[model samples]
Each structure stands twice: as structure tokens, then as C-alpha cells.
Target chain A: MTRKREFTNWIFGRELRDSRELEERPDEERAKPYVITPLGTRVRRVLFCGLVSQKNADESMTRVTVTDGTGNFYISAFNSDFGMQAKAMVDALEINDQVLVMGRVSSYQNEGKTYFNVNPEIAIKVDSVSMDYWRMKTLHIARRKIYAIRMARNRPGSTATDVKAAGYSDLEAESAMKAMEKYPDYDLQEFESAIAAQIQPAAKEEHKSSKDFILQYIQANDTDGRGCRYEDLLAASQNASISQNELDDLLNSLGSDGEIFEVSLKRYKVI
Target chain B: MSDQVKRLKISELVPGTQNVDILVSIVSLQRKELKNERGESVYYYGILGDDTGTISFTAWIFPPTVRIGDVVEIKKASVREYKGINRVYIDAGSEVIMHPGESMDVRRSYSQLKIKDLSTAQPYVTVEGRVSSVREKELERDGKKTMMYYGDLDDDTGKIRISSFDKPLKEGSFIRMEGAKVSEYNGRLRMTLGSRTEVTEIKPSFQVGERLYDIHDISSPLGGVTVNGFIVSLGPKSGLVMRCSACNNRLDDIHCPDHPEAPVAYDLFAYFTLDDGTGSIQCTGGKAALLGHLGFTPEEYTPENKTISRRLVSSRLQEKLLGRAVVIEGDVTRNQSGTSVRISSLNYVDTDFMKKLEARMGADFQ
Candidate 1:
């Protein structure tokens, strides 16, 4: 049987890195093999947005690290005829730039330690709005799996339909069941805590003040019709003694809270 | 304000629950001004959630200080079913107290259903299907003429009518529409595209494929349907018939009153009840659709055997179709009598395929 194209799974770096098992279809040639994550995410293609942390290019290949605050995703684009497009995209990207990449996951075994990286099929430079949107969507997806797994663990011998009846999509329910069967001893609490801490950092009075300042700055400076630029916010944050990481986090949190809307790429508007 | 009221989780909410108290964080918030018969008033609507689940909420009197992601406790909230989904309503009688510094992760789930599974019960829905047809018309609203496009969309499961005002949809495009408003009109499910609805053209990993529907799921009258079932019984009119060559209408007698001089055409009409275990439907077809299955060729038909053809065709149809598993791809139509499928293509399911099909349907129905 001819295998069809696989869906691009929207996943975060944490879960993607946590995936350990790769399943292959030996019976069907040209079938896209997939990895089953500890959370039961059966993914072959993945779509994610993150900040480019590192880049190394050579005649043979281009390697880059993309981090989504939670963890890092290693992407390798081979400089070959079949991988020319991916290599060009990786070559064009710069460190600290936000980018969205959809790619196939490939795993290799070295010294008995299996490692995984993405082979990009499509890559585009995105802005904070797109980045934040991807973050929120991926976070919600992750949370749903967590909840489904928890439900499955709570109800012994529960089927996928039972989990689906608890208000989960069939895909999520099936994935949870698969995860339970494959990772029977996986620590749910530890994974949940780590994800939650990364998604929602502890609130502080200074952070609150900075958020207020960011909102006000956008409102006041968005007068030229084109929303407030990322550079303007960066300058404003620097003047207010807010670090780059804190500013990014504040922007993401504000975007997630629906207080600030990104009108365009790297432009903020108070909604 | 509500010391006696019982605090309930969002998941615990049911329809017609009165004087309910709950604490939840606002996951989504939207402020809207409504101008109605009573006059203009501002209200807030959004989704609220606890650790358990999420519920849509409406607040006629809400604090401006509270925004999305703020945890708040409500006293005297009422739960009511609106558009088939339970919603929490906060009116003047309700008091909302904000709890700053606290947060909650909202668990939101959307029903993933095919076109056939859609109902008005799901107010907002996301569906993926191919646009089967498109009809454009102009509508006058508030003295302004706006174009509205109405059409049908179908997937492997079934088909449904879709209409969009001001939003034009192209035919034959495989699109995924998110947050479309589902409504019912004259016993038909219709999905309307509103401003909030998001439409995206997607390249499906798998083939968009043919329209395959269970007998039970055939509600809307549509085309391009593939139904699998056993021919249980034949209709009274399931035999050979004479059609007026001019208009192609079936003639009750040998002579056509209107086109008396025109020659009559010999046509084989077969009507049967197709039962696929879940349900049954009346199906109709003509000689072109049934000749091969009936083991007859057009060359064999002549005016000489017109009298004997009826019995031969009836028995042949029964012999070839009755009590046998078959597949019919056709169009569904509704009239005063009921719903029936006009067969365009018919095929008998092989024994091996029938076994696999039964296994699949058994799993599906389970």
C-alpha cells in the first residue's frame, strides 16, 4: 500500500525532545516512519515556531538550534539536491530570529544513544505574534494530552471511546491510550509541573509593572497607524530595566491574556 | 451576596441550574454592544474555565477591571441551554468578585465530526469537506444589497448545505472551516460563515475520497453519495416501463396523451429498499444504471418482447439484487412521498469485501 503524506504535528520542544521511540513500517516501502513520544504523540512531520539559538553551516549540511523557552529543537538541513530548499532556508536564518518550521523528524543512533533532529521541508521567518500564537496553540495541545493521559491513568481498563467521551478529540484519546500502554511508568506529575512552570512563570510586582508599561507604550506609540514596532518596545523595556528575555515573556503573556494584540509582524497594539 | 448558594465546578453545570455560584478564570473575553428592542446595552461574552473544564459565559453586568485570564468568583450565576450548549449567564442579580494573582488552565475541546454528524446542537463547529456546488444570490439587508453564496459540501461521511454572506466560496475546493455557525432550516442542517469563522484551504494528507454514508446518516438530500447495503425488498413500481421519448417522463399506458405521435422508449425501472442494518432507504434506478446488473443488454430490448419484459426484468432484478450486499453511488432527493436515492452507479459487494465492510461498520457502530 502506498503511504500518504503525514500531518504536521504541532508540538513544543519539550515533548519533541522527550520522544524516545521511533516506529517504522517494514512492510510498506516509502512509508514515512514516525516517532511515538512518551505522551503518545505519533508524529512524522512537525510544525513549530521558536527563536533561532545557534547555526552552523558547511558544504555538507546546515545545522541549527531552535528554542521555544521550554527546550531546544535541533534541525539539520543537508546540503544535497533533495534538501536544497531546506538548506537555503537554514542558511538564510540568523541567530535570535523567530522562525516557523515544518519538517520531517529523523532519528539516528550513535554510541547506543538515539538522537533526533528535523529535516526542514518549509521554513519561514515569523514575528512575535506568530511565535506567541504557536506557543499558545502548542501549549493547549500539550495540556490536552496531559489531561487525557491523566484521565486514562485514573480509569483503569478505560478505552479510547471512554476518554473521548470526557470531551477529548479522538486523536487525543487514542494517543493517550497508546501513551499509557507504551510508557506505563512515565512520571506525569514531573512532566506536568515542568510544562506548567515554563508556560506560566511566577508573577511578580515588577513584572506586572513592566506589563503595564508595555501596554501603555503600545497604546501611546501606535499612533502612526502601523502598530508599535518591536524595536520601540525593546527600547522602552531597556529604559525600564527589563531584560530581553523578560520582555519576550511579558509580550507572550500579554498576547496570551488577550490584553495586547499583534497587528502585524513584530508590531503590538493594545486590544 | 450568595452565602447559601452552592459552589459548583464548570463541568458540574447543567441546563436550568439556577442561583449557581462558581469560580473560574476568563479564558476568552469579548465586549459587545447590542441594540435591540429594549435599547442599546453593553455586555461581555467569552469562555470561562476551572481546572475541570470550560464553559461559555455571558455577563450583562461585568466589571471593567476584570479582563481575560483573571480568576473571578460569581454569585447567583444561572445556567441555561442556548443553541444546544449550556451557558452561564451573569445578570444584575449576580456579583462578580475578582481574585488577582491566581490563574487557571482552561481545558477546551471541540467536537470533531463529519458533515453527516453535524447538527444545530453544535452551535459553533469546524468541518472539513469539498465544496460540491455553489449558487450565488443577492440579499437586501438594511437597504443594502449583499451577495450570499449557498452551496453544499460533502466528505466521505455525508453532505450538508453551507451558506456564506459576503464571504464567497469557490466550488471544488477542499476547505476546512473553523467556528462556523450551524443552524437548521426546514429539516436541513446549514452551516453559515460568520465574521468569526475561519476558512482555510488545506491539502489533505489522505485522499478527499468519495462520499460514503451509512443509511442511518442520510438526512440531507444530496448528490455523489455511495451507500453500502443489502437489497431487502423491491418497490411496487420496480419493473419495465415505457417512457415518452419527447420528455422522458414515464408513461402509465402504451400511448402518450401529449406526444401521441412520438415513439415510446423502453426503460427498466428498479426500486428497492436498501437496508444496511443501521437503517434503510428507498432507491430507484433506470435501465442504464441496472442493465448490466440485471444481466440484460440494450440490444436484447425490442418492441416485440414489451409484454414479457416486465416479468423478466422484475425477476432478474430480484435474482441479481435481492438479499445481496451491494454498493450504490447516487443522488438523494426528497419529495412528498419520502427520501430516495437515484442510482447513478451500482455494484455488488464481493464476499471478501463484504466481510471487511461488516467488520468496519461493526467497529464504527460500536
Candidate 2:
């Protein structure tokens, strides 16, 4: 007996896909669930990273919303094989935590509307470095998929059988045929722009030192027992190539931690 | 005289189209001499396509004008249903002219390939993996040995050996490399990093240090990863282990097997079973990693006035580690009972991250 074919792992973009159509090959009775994208990808498994926008979990089910710079992904972990893992994540995970989630494709319908969702298998907290890597990595994967979709259309015959015979796998060939049929003449500019915006190797956030840099700046400026003024702090940080937004977040985090305190309005001193 | 030709994508061709023009690449060509009732010749068939799709055409009694892979404009072509699909037949009086200055651009599918799927066909490829080990070897030639580094590169898919003659790598680092060349080495594909290759440390999407897996993810041997579980029990040779000073290999009750004459040094080790409810595995950690996160050293286990510390240490070590929720980073080696972890670093799962939550809710987190 031959082994069953594996479902294709998907690279996601900002585009939302909920086709409300369930498709399976007649030859394979085992159901491999997937959703068709306008770009012609049949998504099965996906890996994504984002900040936790929302999380809610009960004994039977858990749901989470994760948002990257481009868009948001809705994840549901029901009490099946994925229940205990989801419960652990939801009970321990907090809002605003940067998370990486890998899951399978899932969809539902409500009020005659189709909604695509991810059933998270592994959801874990990730650091800034991991977040940067995810963007860089995901961008590359998305680019390759888009290129493959274009290649399929460019090939001679341009049919499912033609693409398969042209050395592409059956999954890819099938997806290409489905995409051309489902979304005729769809523009890829929006998805391309989204990839471009997030794909620049995560800008190499030297953020490891962003917080420490602010604290040292505050210390150096506080002299004669007088606290450092906000203007002086901003000027020094800006000169050091630190953005105003990052400096502000660090200042606020430091202030809350009691590492520094406001002696007066817009003035702070190390405690 | 030349006239402006209409343009239709090859994918848009269908049955029942008359006098319609299309832009397509001549992917194939076949010229044949055929005999009709009066013995006639013909330019038989060819396949044409553009970025959108492809279709076939037959032009009988007309000269073959389009070359394979040449983007052409087919003017006055009519479509007909053939084999349940569409086919465009270019008869006489239709013209097939080269669409000048268009490239037959094709893309090869080798970009961003994972380490496990790497093959020798792809000379240059980009891959991402966690560096499990880096053992620098000396490439010898004419009594000179230039340094070369090789070790295991692992991802979620599988693990492979990676070697670089020019670049140095560290163990337990997540990295992405571009322009790395693949070459067959000892029946397996090995990636070589030359001067043109770029190697940069990558932040992995998952936690770099903590990789908690249940009994399922562990089947065979694995590279460096972390697993969180509870300590079930300990081995008889768990604590107070001696090592050969010359090689640091753990010694038996007599002496090191390889270094019999070498002096020995004493160290503490804890070997026990760790179960995460999915299954269990034997885990090993040293006294330092275990006691460090426990916020104490073996000195705390010793009695005052220079008393003995051997028997007392066993009871206290279990109190520190066994049945406790801890994260252990190590190499997973499989055996009959299942998988076991040879701990490299161990720590109690600290809640330092909870500070981020509290720090946001209020200004005075202290």
C-alpha cells in the first residue's frame, strides 16, 4: 500500500480567505482540510508570530487573536487533541506578549458568511529576536510561494495535469489550477506590499541596548543633585540614533520599575 | 504592410472565439508534410503560452513562423472545443509574428529551501536552522591543515551535518545563511560556506532557549533542545561522580577506562526520570546547574564543623529537583525505555516575564 500524501504547509499574508467551500480529491477518502486563497494556495499548516491582541479560554475551548504588522490571525484550540495545550497557553499567556503560533487550517460559517481560522497546535512566547526572525523568514517563504504561483501560470498547458507533468508536485499544481479558476485577474499588489514592508530582516533591532542606553543617558545628565529634564533626555537619545517612541516606552518601563522616578513634571532621576 | 495586433492572454482562450488575437510563447513546434486527396504539405502543430495559460494550435498548409519559447502574437485565430478543453486552431490567413523584446523568463524553485530538503542539484541555496554543534576540523594538505568547522544543523523537519571551510559557527545558535553551496559528502549533502555566502544569526520564531515537547515530539535522537517536566526518580549513580582530570570523562569506581593513570576530580550529577504527563524520559543535570537555579550550592547541603556531605546530599537533592517543574536543555538520546535527555543547562522556569504584565498595569510596579 502507498502512503498518503502530506498536506502542503502554507505561507500566510495579510489577505483574508474563507471560501465556504470544502474540496477533496475523490481518490483520497481521508479528509485533509484546507482553504483556497485568491493567490491559489491551499493552506494546511502555518506558522506565524505576532503580539497577543486578545486571549480567552475555558475548560473546553481557547481562542486567541495575534496581530503582526500586516494583519491579525484568529486561533481556536478546541478540547480535542489540542485542548490541554491550548488551556496551558491561555491560562499562562498574557496580553501584549509576543507569541509564535504554529497550527493547522480551520474554517467556520456564520450568517451565510465564511470565516477562516487557525487551530493552534503550538503557541509559545517569543522574544524580540525571534519575532524579527519570524518576519524575515516568513517574508522569504511568501515570496517563493508567490513566485511558484506565477511560474505555474507561465508554464505551457497551464492546467493541473500540465503543471504536474512540468515537475511541480500535485499539491502545487492543484492549487495553481484552483487559484486561477477561483480568482480570475486578481491583483497581487496588496500582498506584495505587505511582504515588502515586513521583509527587511526585521531591521536588526539593537533593542537589547535600547533600554540600557536610556538609563545610562539619564544617569549621565543628572548632576548637581538635579534630575534630568525630559528635553535633555530626548535630545541625547535622538543624538544616539534612538527613536522617540522607543525612548518613551523605555522611560515609562523604567519609571514603573522604580529604577527611575519623576522628581518633577517631565524630569526624572535614578532612584 | 504591418498593423497593430490585438492581445489576449493564452489562459483566456476558449471555444467559440473568432478572429481573436492572443499573446503566447511557442513552447513547442512540429512541422509535418501531410498528403490530402491531392497530396498536400502542411505546418502541422505547436503549443503556445504566456504567463496566464497555454493552448495548442495547428496550421495546415501554412509555413511554420513561430519558434519554440518565442513570445508571439497570433492574429485572427479561432478557438474550438477539443478533448473537453479549449484549443485554438490557427488556420491559413492567420499570422503568427514574434512579439519583439519580450523575455521567456522562468523561475527555478530552489530559493529559501530548508536544510533537510537540501540536495546537490542546488549549488547555491538559502536555509535556516539551529546550530546544534560546531567541531572545528583541520583540513590537511601537504603537511598543512587549514581549519574547517562541521556539525549538526537541525530544524523542525530533521537534522543534517553542515560544514564550512571558511566560516566559524557556535553551538546552539539559530542562524540563516544565503549563497551557501551544497556538495555531496560521504553520501549526504553538506553545505559549504565560501566567501560569497552570508551567515547571520537569526532569531527563531519559537523560544530560542525553551523548547518544551511532550512524549510525542521525541522519537529518535535529537540535537540540543529543552524539555519541561517533573523529575520522577533518580539512579544509584546519580550524585558524587568522579571524572578523569586529563579528559573530563566520567570515571568509574576504580579509574577512567581510557585514562587509567590520570588523576580524578569529583563533581555532582543528578540522573533521574522526568515525566510531563504525556510520557517520561531519563534526564541528567550537574550539581551546579541544578543548585544554581535552586538558589544554593552543595555547601548548604554539608553539615557544620566539617561534617560528612555524602549521604545528606541525596535526600536534599531530591527535595531541590524531584517532582519540581523545571526546564532542562540537553541532547535527547533514545533507548529501549524511550528518550532521555543529557542535560546541558537546567533552570527553574522563572516568572520574570510576569513583571512585563504588572509593569504595564501600573506605574509603580515595585
Candidate 3:
């Protein structure tokens, strides 16, 4: 039988980082390995949107840390044939660039804990509209899974058929059953609280002040005509209690308003 | 007699199971006549279902009174694998007993969907719509004659073609139908209703209108749908093209081989990709969809002009369409390669969609 294309799961960084169980496909050389999250979803590939908070690039490798509103996702691309496209996409990106990425999940174990990273296949700079769309879609899917799990938990003796009869999809039914069996002691409250917190309104006034401070810092810090380095701006914003995600949004808003532009990767100039 | 037989659900009818007893409702039934070594014989074959699932069953001796939707208990039946599918066979030792007071709830695996949601990947569907524009014809196959009804079904969402075998639908009648098989041909979807399909006439509750959809929700081929998106990429083959005047077939050479004596006509063929943030689709258009937008007239775009080149037309299309948001009404189709939309009508959107989107989605997050 021909292997079907693995589904690229649309999920947030918080849920993805919570995956603990890894399943190895039978074909050691040909098959792609995957991990089972606490939600009981088998994730081989993932599609997400986040801000580029950190980047380390060299001749052979490129690693970047991307942060959605909830948590951080680590992406690594190499110079090999499989990684060339991803590396080139990251090479063109600067700090605080919002991007959309689709990639296979790669994981490692250290100190009795598993750490997951993305081996990117495709990455592109996206607009705020696309980012918002991703967030909405991911939230909808997550809520559906959570509902299925809760239904199964309430009816402990229920089977997948019972869940399906309640109008959930087959994938959701199976995952809910698996989650019930695998993570019996897992805290459902924590997941619900996190999702509820996501619904809160963003801090608008605080954002305006941070945007102002960043603009002033860049205007005063272009000492040698190369403009201010992103690292310096990041440090200055951190001192003022601003987060990487907020800085990303501020820089993007500034660029859209024609207040600043990037002279090179990780270097910005006030226009 | 019942104590010795093992009762099981239809889903548990595994291959090579013996003395298998099951209580199921007849979902569908068809009679087959065959001339074997023992002379002419008749057998009933169809699908049986319970609350768990459904299974195909063949019986050499079937109860004469059993009909579709009748509940019957079969005892001492044998299950065997045939053509890689598990089937229940009721032979000489089997007994089918009917209990008049009992009724079983049949299992339905298909989802109730709108006409716009139908896809080839989904094998079965349950839908409700008003039947209209019915055409009846007699079709003969393998020395047997049957009546075939072809028509269009419309709900509030959209319209799709429905083909029924032997069963006739009244024009302008509202009905709810289940187990209609979905298939695609000539880049459009058609629902095939056969013996397995159950139909019920219903009172019309809603009015049908033009349906606009998001790109992400369009997973099937549909006719007459509208979408709002931005033209993101232009295809390489887009621009001016030559066609045979007599047949309108696209021509690569100066004159057409099929109509060498006929004149050649210059036409506009533009192709591009449309993205709406939710999803994206490749789109193709012809002279009717593009000529007015490209500022071209039939009299001016003739072969007589020496300075006018394909490059000019290509550049003109890019300048006017690339990254521009528009409302496009078209037929969306799917082939082996991927899904695409053939443009029937196109117009620029004057509204700032971001402002509209902010107004629509802002309340939830805020």
C-alpha cells in the first residue's frame, strides 16, 4: 500500500510542547517518526504561525525560536537537500518577523525529558490577517478536541462509536478515547484555563508606549550609520518589561506605518 | 434452536465465522435471477444494518414478506470473506424470523451535508433539497430496461445535479434523501441515487439563494459559487492566444489544422492564483472574463497589429490584477492535479476587507 501524506496538524505551541509519547513507524529507514500529544493527537507534521524571537544562522545550520502568544516553538533547518528551502526562508527573516511555517516534527530526549523541534519544509512571512486566521482555526480545532475529551470523560464506559454518534469526527473520537486511556491523571482544568485566558483583550495602551520607546531608541542609537541592532532593541525593551511578542507586533506596526525599515537581517533603521 | 447460535452485531461479522446469528434491519434489497446447474434460481442480496454498523448479506432463501426497513433476525448464518469484504450468507440451515412488534434503528455513517459540501472523497451523503428541472429517459443495459431521472436539487446553500435510477422524483417537490452516492464527472459533482437510497417528501421550509463561500470550506467541485480573494500569482501561459475561428479550438500555429481555410481569432486567456487568507485556489479565465478588465477590444486586438505582442498583454494583466482584491463568481473544479476555479464573472471589491474583518472577528478576542 502506498503511504498517505501525513497530516500536518494545525496546533499551538503550548499543545505541541506538551507532547510526551513518541511512536516509531515500522519502517525504520523510510517512515517518518511521530509523537502523541497529551491530547492523543499523533503529530508528524505541524502548521503554525508565530513571531521570530531568536535566530542563530551559520554555514551548516540555522536555528530560530518562534513564539506564538502562548508558548515558544524551536525550529532548526540544516544545509542538507531536505532542509535547503527552509534554511533559505529563515535566512531572509529578521528578528520580530511574523511568519507561517509548515514542517515535520523532530524530537530528542535529554535528562529524562523529551524536547520537540520542527524540521521545517516551508516557511513564509505572513501578514497580520493570516496570523489571526491561523489563531482562529487552531482555537476552533482545539476546542472541538477538548469537547470530545470531556464528553468521553463524562461517559467513562463509552466507546468511539458513542462519541461518533454525538457528532464528533472519527479522528476526534479516536483521539479522545486514546487520551482517556493514556492520560487519566492529566489536568483538564489547566488546558481550559489557558484557552479561556486567550480570549482576554490585548493591552492597547501599554502597546502604544512600547512602540514609542522602541522608535525613540532606534532614532537615537544609529551611531555608525548601520542603525540599531535587533539585539540591542530586544535588551532595551526587556528592561522596560516588554515581551518579545509585543516587540514583534510593534516593529511590524512601525514598518506598516513607514516609521522604520530593516537595513539588513537583525538590523533596523528609523525612516 | 436459538441457544446454540452465537448472536453478534453487524460490525462483528468477521470472516470465517460460523453459526453467526444477527438481528438487523434491511436497509436495501435487490433480487437476482440466475440459471445454475440446478435450474433457474432467485436470490436476495442487499445491505443490512443495526445501531452498530452495516454489512452486505446474500440469501438463497429469503423471507417473502421482508422489505426494506423491516427488522429480521437471522439464525445459523455463515460469514465468509469474498473479494476482500466480509459478507453474511444464509443457506439451507439458516432461519430468518420476523418479529412484528420490534423495530431496529439502522446505522447511518454518512453525514447530512449541503450541496456545497459534497465531495468525491465522501462516498455517501444525506441531503435535503427541492427537486427541479427534472428530465426522464429510458435506459437499457445488459438486455434490461430501466427509467433514469436526471435533475437539479437546490437548498439554501447551492445546487447540484441528482441522477436517480428507476426511482422518479416529482418536479418542484421538496425531499430529504439519504445514502446517495457522490461521484464526479466532467469537473462537476453528481449525486447517484439507487436502491440503497431512501427518499422522503418533506414540506419546504427555506428559500434557495446564491451562496458565497470561504476558500477553505470549498473542498469539492461546485457550480455557480462566489468567493472574495486577492490575485496572488499569475500563470506563465496567461496572455494573448490564437484560436480557430470556425471551431474556437486553441491554435498554436498561425492557422488551425482542423480548419486551415478558416480565419484565426485572437483571444485573451488569463490564469492566476487567488488567496483569501483562509485558503487559496488557482483560477483560469478567458476573453469574456478578462477582455473588458484588460482594456482590450476585439477590433483592436486583431492579428493586423504588428507592434502588439504577447509580452504587452502579459504585462498589462499583471499591472491590473496582481495583488488586487476582487469578488469572483465561478465554477470550482477538481481533477487529479488539484482544485481550481473557472471564472464566469469577476469584479473588483471596493470595501476595505480588513476593516470588515476587524469588525466581525474583533468582538470574540476582545
Candidate 4:
């Protein structure tokens, strides 16, 4: 049907993985080509939007590095399969121009380490509206995938179809399934924070302010350096932007980091 | 949520089954009076279906409260093979209970309903289908002449004829019709729109590209099929045209033959030949579709504003869409000159318009 696959995610370049390990594995069974990230994402394809920082072409192959908010992704267009696209990339595209690229993940092993890159199928020079639209769309998709992965993990018996029936798209469900199968005991808080920061930078900024307020309020209220009462601290922390639950987590972490100490029962003192 | 024996779907019923219980929607029912072992017996035989599948059934004892569209639980039923198909039978000793507080979710069932699932025995049904053709017919009944509009409606599953007595429909429109009268004609099901039916036009909620058929292989009228091809050339009628204001007919000059002193209105059209390497077909669009194809707003290039010339619009359309790989959806009507599509929607595949259009329509794409 000449159906071109649609990839709707703008993943950070840092979360990409080298597909060298899977390529090296010797198995008779056919496996779908996907790159596994540290946060346990199976990258079948990605909708990447960024600025063209550098372009390198040698005869039939052209390679370009694109810089996003977090990092840069290496993009390549080969000759035999993507002859016209490779030529266009080399001759037409210039550095510093924003482009949107949909591509499959590729990688190579260098000495002992592996690096990840992309083999673009659809690439277009875009203006600001197109670039920003793709960026926000990808951010939402990535965030949804993060949440779906966590929910699928908690429900082990659920299948990809089950996850899909629970409001996730087929691609996201399959990604979650692959994420679970590839990465075991996957810690998600770091990825959660990364996605949270990307989708809504304003919310993250607000959260940072609440963290600072908690620390300052504790320091100011601890008179005689004898620590502050729990009830009094809660009252003061409630005045800040964060919720009661978030305030509790901040207080526990502050104590664990030796920034605060328990002077008495239900009381805290800054260290 | 309990560890209980779940209700069986209609497809799970097989021959020689005993003491089986299932939840099924009564798709149809009819009472027949027969004389045999019992001098005269009244029994109900009909079809039942669930989300999984459908099966015909005969009930020796029919309950008064059990009606069509009621999701009911039938107990103590046995399965019997009838003409190579399974039929579940509930004897006179069995019970037909109208289980309260148990019905399929209204919204879920409506979205999942399809034209192929419809039967003549169904009293009322709701379905979404594409209008393949609309034709007017005149007939005499009881010494009175009446005009009727017939439309061929199709979904992915199959096609059915819709008889609209007073309602007018466009030749190629996607619509969701509710409470259509179901009837059988020539062994196939047909739906009639009477006083109680209502239809609302809807855009496609799913993608159509499953098999990009070779244009050469399609020999007959094809509906709801997706094809990918390149816009090879623009047709002669690809530019602007003037229509008679009073008659809505194409005018060769400033005046129409029907109304000599009538005013004229301007309109835009875009038709092009699409070649997919296998073959080529002519694709045509209406004014709205043409404007969307050209990426122009109606307000910018209306008849009142002569800033943009007809030749300019035509040349711009050709320059923008020609030679580009595109995906189109609609029916292909065949004649002596082969097939042509009345394009319902067209996409250039890798453009900004796809993102905007698909997102606004809430279409599910991957």
C-alpha cells in the first residue's frame, strides 16, 4: 500500500543505543531491528528535529550531525538505498539549518565502545513552526511512552494488546513490551525526570523553586539551632508551591544527605 | 473481578454442547407456528451475536421481556449442527432471563459496529459507511408515482443499498446513519431511511492504505480502497470555471442559456492524472478539496477578490502537487476509458498539511 511508517517521537540523542550487540548476536530466528536505550526504549524509528551542526559526505555516503536541546544525533544517508536523498543532503542542505528527520537507528563498534547513529528515510528542511511542532509532538509521545512502560512493568501478565486497549497506541504498546523484555529491573525515576523536564520546562522550574523554599524555610525557622517542630514546618512548607507529599520527600532526602538532623521526635535541625 | 466461569461467546458454542451459558445480544427473532408432534407449536428462531461471532438459535419457549439489543444470559442450552453451521437451541425446559444491569456500553458498541454485521432481522442498527453512488429512481405504487433516492453504502466489510425516501445525500460522502430500517432484497440486506432515521456526515477515523492496488487490476467500481501514486499530469478541467448563478450549471460565457440575464459565480477545480508505475488514473476534487490541495484559504482567492488569476492558481497547483508521491482515497468508477476517482481526501505524504489535517481530524495514524 506504499504505507510509510510514521514515527512521532523526538528522543534525546543521549538516550540512544548502539545496535551493534543485537547485530552481533547469532540467532536463526528473525528479529525485528530496534535499538535499546539505557531507559529500556526500543527505537524502531524516531522523529528527530534539530539544527544541522556538521555535514560530511564521501562519494556515495553523506553523514550529518544534528544538535538538539540535550545532545546531538548522528544522521547518515547511504548511496545504494538512499542515493537521491544522500545527494540532496550533501548538495542542498547547509549547516545551522533546522531539519526534521525520521530514521531508523544504526550503530558501529569503535575499539571497545559503541556509538549510535541514524539512517534517515525521510528528511526535510523545515521552518520554525514545523520544527517546534515536531518537538512538542515528540515530547508528548516520549512522555506517554515513559508512563506506559512503567504501567506495563507493574502489570506483568498484561500483553501489548492489553496495554493498547488501556488507551495506549499500538506503537507505544509494542515499545513498552520491548522495553520490558530487553531491560530487567529497570529504574525509571531518572527517565521520568528527563521526560518531565522536556515536556514542560515551566513545571520543572516551579518544582525547583519549591525545593529551594523547603531548605530556606527549615533554616530560618530552626531557632537556637535546635531544629524545627514537624507541625510548624508543615505549616510553613504548606505556604510554598509544592504539595505536602513532595515536601515530605524533600525533607527525607535532606536528612539523608546530612543537610538536616532530628533534634527530637517530629523535629528537624539543619546540619 | 472474581474467580468465576466467564460468559461464553457465541463463537465458542459448538455441536454436542450441554449445560452451556453465554451472554449474547439478540440480533433477530421471529415467531413461527408449526404442527408436528405437538398439534400446533409456536417457537422463536433467530440469530444471536456477540463481539466474537454470530450464531443462529431456536428457542422453544420465548420470553416476553427478551427483545432485540438486549444483552441476555441464556441457561441450559445445547448446541446442534445445522447445515454445516452451529445453532444453539434452548428447549422449553430452559430459562430465558432478562438479566438486569447488563448491556454493552453504548459508545463502545457503536464504534465497533460494521455493515457486515447487519441483518434483516435487526429492528434498528447504526453504521458508518461511505456513499459509493447516489441515483434517483421513479416508481408507481398503488396508482401513485413516487421519487426515491438510492445510495450504495460501503464499509470495509461489505456493501449495502440505502433507500432514502426524502433525504438527499451526496454521491461521495462518509456518514454515520442511525435507526435505518433493515430489509432484505434479492437475498442481500438493504436499509431504508424513513421518518425515524438520522444521518450525520463524518470524516474517516482510520487509515485506508492496506493494499496499494495496481490501477490496472481494478476492473469494476471499487470503494473505500487506498492507492499511492504520483501526480503525473494535470487535466484540462484543472483550473477555474464560471457557474450560472441561477441554474448552478457550467457557463461557457457570462450568460447561461437557461437564464439569459442571470449572474455568474466563480469556482475552482483541480483534477490530475496519477501514475503509480503500474498504471494511471484521473483524480478529481471539488472546490474545497481543490483549495486544500493547493494549500490556499478560500477567503484569499474568492470570486470577490480577483487578485489571483485562474491561470496562476492552475499553475501553482501543478507546480506544488505534480510529480510528488501522494496517497488518495475514494471510489474508482470504471467505464470505457478505465477508472477515475472522486477524491474524498488526498495527501502528499511528507508535507506539513498531513500533520495539520490528521491532528485536527483526530485520525489514528502510525
- TM-score leader: 3
- DockQ-best of 3 and 4: 3
Q: Compute the DockQ of candidate 4.
A: 0.02
DockQ of each: 0.01, 0.02, 0.10, 0.02
Candidate 3 TM-score versus the reference:
0.55
The better-scoring model by lDDT among 2 and 3 is 3
Residues B188-306 of candidate 3 have per-residue lDDT tens digits of 88898979799999987788765667676687788777776556567878999998999999998988999899998889888887765446788999888888887877778888877
Q: Could you tell which candidate, 1 or 2, scores higher by TM-score? A: 1
Instruction: Give the CAPRI class of candidate 3.
Output: incorrect
Best by lDDT: 3
Q: Which ten residues in a row have the lowest lDDT in candidate 4 chain B?
A: B104-113
- Poorly placed runs, candidate 1 (over 4 Å): A1-271, B1-16, B19-112, B133-151, B163-167, B179-198, B205-207, B210-226, B241-250, B254-268, B277-281, B286-288, B295-309, B330-344, B355-366
Arranged by lDDT, best first: 3, 1, 4, 2
> Chain B TM-score of model 2, please?
0.47
Task: Give the per-residue lDDT digits (tens) of candidate 2, residues A1-271.
Answer: 3342233343543544424455565675776656677656666666666767677877788787776645557788777764675557555667667776666777677766667788775577766644544554355445544555676656745777776665555555666777677765656655665445444433324325767656755664463347866655664454345677988888899989989998988888888
Clashing pairs in 4: A1-B212
Interface RMSD of each: 22.5, 13.5, 6.6, 10.6
State model 4's lDDT.
0.64
Clashing pairs in model 3, backbone N/Cα/C closer than 3 A = none
Q: Model 1 lDDT vs. the true structure?
A: 0.75
